[model samples]
Target chain A: MASQAAIGFTRGAPSLDIIDTEGLVEATRLAFAEDPAGTTAYGTAVGYAPLRKWIAEQHGVPVEQVLVTNGSMQADAFLFEQLVSPGDAVIVEAPTYDRTLLNLRQRGAEVHPIALHEDGIDVDAVQALLESGVRPKLAHIIPNFQNPAGYTLSAPKRARLLALASQYGFTLFEDDPYFSIRFEGEQLPTMLSQDTSGSVVYASSFSKTVCPGIRVGYLVGPAEVIAGIAKIATTTYISPNMVSQSIVNQFCRSGRLDKSIDTVRAALRQRKDALVAALERELPKAEYTAPQGGYFMWVRLPGVSIDALADAAAEHGVAFVKGADFLLEGGDDSVRLAYSGLSAEEIDEGVTRLAAAVRSLDA
Target chain B: MASQAAIGFTRGAPSLDIIDTEGLVEATRLAFAEDPAGTTAYGTAVGYAPLRKWIAEQHGVPVEQVLVTNGSMQADAFLFEQLVSPGDAVIVEAPTYDRTLLNLRQRGAEVHPIALHEDGIDVDAVQALLESGVRPKLAHIIPNFQNPAGYTLSAPKRARLLALASQYGFTLFEDDPYFSIRFEGEQLPTMLSQDTSGSVVYASSFSKTVCPGIRVGYLVGPAEVIAGIAKIATTTYISPNMVSQSIVNQFCRSGRLDKSIDTVRAALRQRKDALVAALERELPKAEYTAPQGGYFMWVRLPGVSIDALADAAAEHGVAFVKGADFLLEGGDDSVRLAYSGLSAEEIDEGVTRLAAAVRSLDA
Candidate 1:
């Protein structure tokens, strides 16, 4: 069973070795030891106060503009619930996060997909859609390193997206979990930072940076929007997990978060480099982006069907996500490979196996 | 500010002294020490595996039928998201949990509130609603120690309610957060325990039984329903808090939960006794149920508006939730007093102050 098991390139999980498990455990222990009762009692629906304030300060926002959530996904869910009425127009990038697409579809939004380029989503296409007289209630974008796409939205596009949101009267829902994971390239200004019209609702998660098991995230937006989301949160989860929040709060306050992120960034850079080199050596015909950071790389194999490639790759003991899963329309020749959880050696082996699978398909 | 503060009878929080804080801290510590990586990594959207298995074992259900949630409220949100469409009929107890009512309202559920009596909800009224051709998508009930009412659904009513659900082709959403909190009377069989038709979606929380800050809860239902809820959970929060679930799993497996429950029951029973005796002495005119267990006592003050009484009580150094907050139609002369958070002495003082408030309103 072990011999036949696939080398996984489909998981977005952070490498376990990179996680500061000792620090997390110590923080949790301290949280329980210091104030067990307070830590274990019901917290406000918005989140634990100190954590919310901390996040607010980090984002240079007022506390009223910030709300802590179970995770960034919960933040997305709450904002979707608050903004997307049935049949409302919602804009999404073509190759966006699949779960976000599912959420928008479930919310009954008429999702308009804008083409995602190497630099970012096509702002001109979005502008065209807006000019077509579709009044979108929200536009969900990952301005930093996008999931599945691994492309950062250019600074110019970020500015334009903010302007479009203002002109079209839609909320720019910026999901930026990988904003701090950059290993190269200059950091782009966030859509939230660029927006003067209070149209950007920014969300980020500790899942990628700290620990997903803690389930902590924060949303920053206008006070009224935050309050509305908090109300939804009250009826949804009552409160975010205070025990985990307290632990995270301690981890942040102790300045361990910076060190943890540094370790993660360094490790991820190594893995990303290994995957890119392996791809070049093994799959010469494959077209792919070298992501500066984040978990995924969008790969296009010329003359190869993504479905067949994925199936054959699995049989050859390597696995990846079919790119069609990320797109609403078409991606028959594409796949998404995640290298964040794999070691450099494992990535090399996985790419070699994937190349063998591709050759076998041709044979 | 401390001197002028009112005695608080308004909190739904469990007493801090009663929680086995040391045990909780130890469990958390053990969880971290045993498997920090597994405990702090991404888990399945359904929940942490061992915790789901444990809950399944406790409920005598299959693991597939159990999905751990952020809290019981999140379970409700998932189910509501799955089952209720806009304008769908939903049966709720007249004086149900305010959050449930708010969630239903937000979902655009045509909420039909049936009267809640001393022995739980008016089952006959529910039957009448069904018989009157109102086909509700779900009937939500708190079978044991119903929130704000301090009533248990009789065994016969539970059976009848199940039958009604089957007859009406609606799910019976049995929310039993306080199931294990019984301090007196014989324990009633759960609606889920008696269910054979697979129409009951049972939800319960460790927040009340273990600790709220941990934010762990679960749902048991048909595999298909659980799968659907898990799908929603995927888009909602991605997964339940594994750190908390791991700790709760440790707490349960270590044979500490039973002892903790015993401690809580004893403390709550004492506080209930104090509140009951004080009400009898200080405000004999007010009618209230002496709850067998749970945190709340429902009081109906004769010839007094609850809002006015709540205002008067606050000014006279006491506080409680006005009954109107818990109802759909009317609770003008009622209020909900929670005794779980207060000490026995505080309960007596709070009641005495409440009596003074009542007199002041009359004066």
Candidate 2:
């Protein structure tokens, strides 16, 4: 049972070398030592209280406005389940996170995929849609280091989208799990921070920073909205796995989390550098955004209709998600490569294999 | 914000005293020491491989037939999502878990409430319903130590239910979370273990034995069906949290889990005895089946319409769920008291307060 060896760039997960295993184990020790009762019992649907409080403090929200979850994906699902009904109009970026699109479609929503430009989604297009009787109940956006596209939503676009949401009487679901992994660009204020009309429900995860194994994430919204979702959560999993969240709480409280984030940013920055350099060296004709931070970089080779790129690349011991996987339609020539889960050397090798596959397609 | 102190019998969670905290922490140390990568990475939807393998071995099934989840409620929800659609008929016990009814109703299922006898569900009623052309997509049953009722389905009833499912072409979802927590009666075989036909999807949780905070549960079925739910899980939360499950794996591997289960069984048996003795002493007119094992005792006071029982009990610093909360109709004379989350002393004190509240209602 020998498994095939491959350079995996398909999943946006952190490389093992970068994870602070000692710190997490230490945090677990601290969780049991300090809050054994909270960790070993079904605490509440609101999640580990200290973790929820910490998240609320980070977002400048009241404690009642925050609800920690199993992961940001679960947070997204809960929000969708709370707000979306079958046939309800919902807006998403054309090349959003594949799983997000999958969840929305599974819920039978009328998903209207709008174009995502370098500066973020075409905000004017959203305004136009809103004006033309496309009464979406929610607009989903990944504000910073957006998945698949690896483009941050510009501040102006963020404000414009928020304004449009307030104007159109629709909620803005801000899915920003990659908010803190930025290696370049100053941190932008969250839409939730700026919302005066209670239109934003923001979500983020500790997966990219702490580690994927922990699976702790949270949402910050209006008190009423959070409470309603908490009720749904009570019936869903009877409160999420609190043992991890309690450890996460201890991790955050111990000042190790900030250090871990710094460690991740520095390591991923090197990986990103190696990835872009290799892409330029190998595929000079390739098109991609120069991602400043986060795990992924989008690549498309111009004048190349290589619909079989993912398969061909896989044959060469390289793995990546095809761009079409993230779209309602279109993206056949594109692919998203996650660099976070690879060493700088591995990224170089993976991209070389990817370039070779592209050449084979051209042949 | 002065929160009222209450003796909680409302949640069927294990008391902190019974949980093997030292064993769990030791297991966590072992998890980090032995399989850091497995615990820290984004594991497959099948869950931590060794744990999955362990579960498969225990059930005498292939690893391909199992998919672990955040909890059994999640497993239930996934199965419901996969099988039941709006207006599809689903048969459940009349006094089932409240959250089960909540989830089914939310999915818009035309739920049929079957009568639950001391032995189990009335199979003849199900046959009559089937004769009347109610084509149920699924029949949900808790074969051993059921929630709220704490009654184990007899072997004959289990066999008959399996036969009925095979004949009617409906899936028998064996939700036996408390299968191992028994302190009395011989261990009966699971319906899944007995089924020759492909008609049972079984789920169980480690929450009862290990601790609720760990939140690891699983489903076992035919390979194709488990594969389908695994895909839904991939879209749902990427993967189940591997941290606790990995520790749970270590606990199992090290043979600590059996010892811990024994500890839990011994402690809960004492609590159960204390609860029953107090009930008989305080409420002589109370009607209750003497529970053999597990957490709850369903009590129906004859000629007593204390519909405000839960509120009155809460006023006296004792808490329990009203029986009507679990049923679609007619549980005005009943309540479910979970003794697992209380000490023997607390159970005695709580029952005393509950009897006082009942007397107030009678006055």
Candidate 3:
């Protein structure tokens, strides 16, 4: 019925139930109680020292290699601004985060879209493009639980990409926000960790792990580039949100962050199962690679036009992102359904509504 | 002795004693308990609606005219990106906030520096430039307690600026973080409030009023431009720190913000008086405009090179910014001393040390 509430699978934000509210509250108290100066003052653009140290310890990088930002998106934007000057060529997955693509284009970067497989981005395609004298300044890779597609890069491919970046003299932007959210399979070594040369610049966020509203994210790279980005950040906003970083630092140190991640993983696992089962039973014609973990399931119906289905799906009280929105071109028949923010019941309901819309479109 | 601790006048941050720590603790609790979704979710780049509504009510604008950012500096950068393309001319105060000048130059804007008097920016100079066919796309004005200079814009100049902006088809950017921190005389109306035409985009921050670590700031403009900026914010970073904004909302709603502002004003007034008295007693040759309110006092030593004075000042356990840092060129004898972050006794001590430094420079 039209009166039924819309069951949205659009945003990849975590559900309220999955967040550790009690832990965050306690963490906030600890942050304020312990270090009032670090928590309340105008912290330098290098970020709160303790938070950076914590991240540095986690990554095995020196403290100067880390720059804490408002969010990983800000980190992405800063690195893009630093690396990709106007008219410089860059490589990206065919279906990448639209926001990153928009930023690259805004900076006048010549975008080269490489195809992606279930294992992750086409490294051979990137190598081929590089061999063809593309000479990209940057290669933006999601690395794990890739947005829109939910594909993780294989270890071999990651190694290859690093090598290509080293050889091509391009920066490999390892945008790995979902690295820790894997509910299944062994985590692959990051391109940053794998790089012998300083070709990889890594980015991750506490948004998905700790909660989005805290706005804590960071970048890890060579000290030189990190210092350059910090300079840009210093001029951009004198500093990031130190209060949030302080709280997040507490969360990480207090073992609450790991606990919260476990809780979110359990909930997401259930949601993903519900989504897959519902899709199989309801829209049998649809095709997708089952995501091992992360927030999304990318699917394409054999004959359905996503634009028409989107309107029909809305009337049927379901919402999802059209996959074409993530790509520069193509994906007219595809959709990206984020299961992270929904429960099993909501996922089932949303998939039913989506199936009903597709059937209606055919009729 | 070389072992004395440095009393720095470099940062314009508030002294922690004036921050309402107890009130903030309560606000954080209230924000977390009352509005869990609004405080913890991935709020839209347009910002949390309640916070936007509050800011809109404060400014007497529609909610659509507001876009909350990580900080007002981000608001400044976004507007610069939106308005000034490469080589587009823009006007700014000569010895203005330096970070602002950096962002403008980074965007490749041809910055036309206007002079400032005790009353405010030299509107006549801007008028001359515009009259002489330098059609600047935008003019950045800090109407209240201008940074580094600590001068307030006169009402007449404010009116003329609004008129000039309208007549020349230029956007008047009123970057007024220090608007509410005025501790003396009658409060002046914002240029945004006084403008009859839709030519003004105004920004303000909770960094000075509430606390810096929160990183909550906002922009108000016509709905169309606000929408455009919101779009840019969305692609750059999906949203701002909602937890911080929610706490700030609580701080504002419960009247704690008013109390905090009162405490800060009282403290700043004492520090300002101490600074003026000490300057008179210690270094009669150092000419300065005694600011009635705000954090900074701009002073020019008749013949002392700031570079030499800075080195001497450092050794004497005092620190102040060389005002030349704020200008593109030619401020070799000026310094900006921020007294807000220090107590009256500390200001006196610092000025004494500063006098000693000047003596050393003469030697």
Q: What is candidate 2's lDDT per residue for A107-191, written digit by digit as tens?
A: 9999999999998999988989988999999999998888999998999988998899898889999998888889987888889
In model 3, state the lDDT of residue A244.
92
lDDT of 3 by residue, B51-78 (tens): 8899999999999999998888888988
**lDDT tens digits, residue span B79-110, model 2:** 99889999999999979999999999999999
- Model 3: per-residue lDDT, tens digit, A170-259? 899999999888988887889888788999999999998999998889999999999999999998899999989999999999999999
| TM-score ranking from best candidate downward | 3, 1, 2
Write down the TM-score of every candidate.
Answer: 0.96, 0.96, 0.98
Worst 10 residues of 2 chain A by lDDT: A1-10
Q: Tell me the DockQ of each model, to 2 decimals.
A: 0.73, 0.80, 0.79
Q: Choose 2 or 3, whichever is better by lDDT.
A: 3
Which residue runs of candidate 2 sit more than 4 Å off their true CA positions? A1-4, B1-5
| Alpha-carbon interface RMSD for all candidates, in angstroms | 1.4, 0.9, 1.0
Q: Which residue segments of model 3 deviate by more than 4 Å?
A: none
TM-score of chain B of each: 0.98, 0.97, 0.99
Error of 2 at B264 (Å): 0.8
